[model samples]
Target: MTGWLVRDAVAGGLAGAIVGGAPSTLHALLTGRDPLAASYAAGRMVLPSEQRPARLLAAAVLAHGALSLGWAVPIAAATPPRRAALFGAAAGLAVAALDLGVVGRRIPAIRALPQGAQVADHVAYGVVVALVCARRRVRRG
Candidate 1:
């Protein structure tokens, strides 16, 4: 059980870092914005916006991975692999509501971006994490 948990966390984290962060970063870059800066602004809850150095991109990526892993643990434990994708999408919606409805309203930096983009990014996160965790579970079984 402990090993499975660890595997899930590590897998989810890596998936979130790559599958989740890459799209948003690329989108921000293509739109003529600094990826790290955008990430800092959006994720001010984890890392402050003031420290928006390019070097901090690694930290931001790691933070996303960590948060993804944390979110994955309970979801993995609670849901079966067969329903992972659906549950993951629901999780994404919940995250979107919390972020846009609550965090964005409270945080000026985060509110600067379009709500739609954030929702898409969050859904991407959920789907990637769900797929990764499900794969891990299936492989183990």
Candidate 2:
């Protein structure tokens, strides 16, 4: 039970990293700062996964992180918390919509990161897979 929670938190945080990376990157870009340099500093939410044996579990974590990333900080970066929350959810939904658009479609040989995406698409899949499996376990229990 504890392990599952730990996994979720870590997955949540990694998702947080993805969530936080964008606006932080945007901040850096507009200011002519190096986005990579700020990646960890601003994107410190991702922690190492505790559930290594479960592949699908990890991938869901990635997707959750991606979903979280698409929503979280950027909305709150400059606006009021309430407004940020609304915008964050909107951003999350937009990203989710995009994911829905391409989730099963093959990318041929390579899945390139979009112009401002911080992490690669494949890596995100791995994390998301883990998260998904974890969720299934939670449901079963």
Candidate 3:
């Protein structure tokens, strides 16, 4: 269990960096910074999906969902009831964007695409990660 948590933390944090930092990369590139700067600056490897296998990806998924729960619950609790739903919605979208855009292999072209396409990509990442993590928990039996 201890080993799992440690691996999950590293995997998830790296995954989070990938997801959250994509925008930083885009921001850098749009402003004329080295495109590879984001890749090295964050201490993240940014490896290709083909290089990662099912279980490692599953660990990453679990880590992301755990991070999402940590963010969402607190925001919901802190916001006013009337505004809680909106807050949750925005948080969910932000999580999806971070996870999908950088961590789950979405490209910056999302900003160029239709809004629905962007939403779909992020939502897909969230949903798949949720499913993979759930399956992993069951498999640990």
lDDT of each: 0.68, 0.40, 0.41
* TM-score against truth, every candidate: 0.76, 0.29, 0.32
RMSD of 2: 15.6
Worst 10 residues of 1 by lDDT: 49-58
lDDT of 1: 0.68
TM-score of 3: 0.32
- The lowest-lDDT stretch of 10 consecutive residues in candidate 2 is 104-113
Model 2 alpha-carbon drift over 4 Å, by segment: 40-141
- The CA lDDT at 11 in model 1 is 76
Error of 1 at 118 (Å): 1.2
Model 2 Cα lDDT, one tens digit per residue, 52-100: 3344345545544554533333322322223333443454444444543
What is the model-wide C-alpha lDDT for candidate 2? Answer: 0.40
Tens digit of per-residue lDDT, candidate 1, span 1-141 = 588877786777567546765666677778887666546764565566546555455555566566667776765565467877787777767777876788677877667765666777777777777777888888878
lDDT of 2 at 124: 38
Question: How many angstroms is residue 7 displaced in model 1 relative to the true structure, after the best TM-score fit?
Answer: 1.8
Give the alpha carbon lDDT tens digit for every residue of 64-109 in model 3: 3555445433332333324333443465477656644665354332
How far off is residue 141 in model 3, in Å? 38
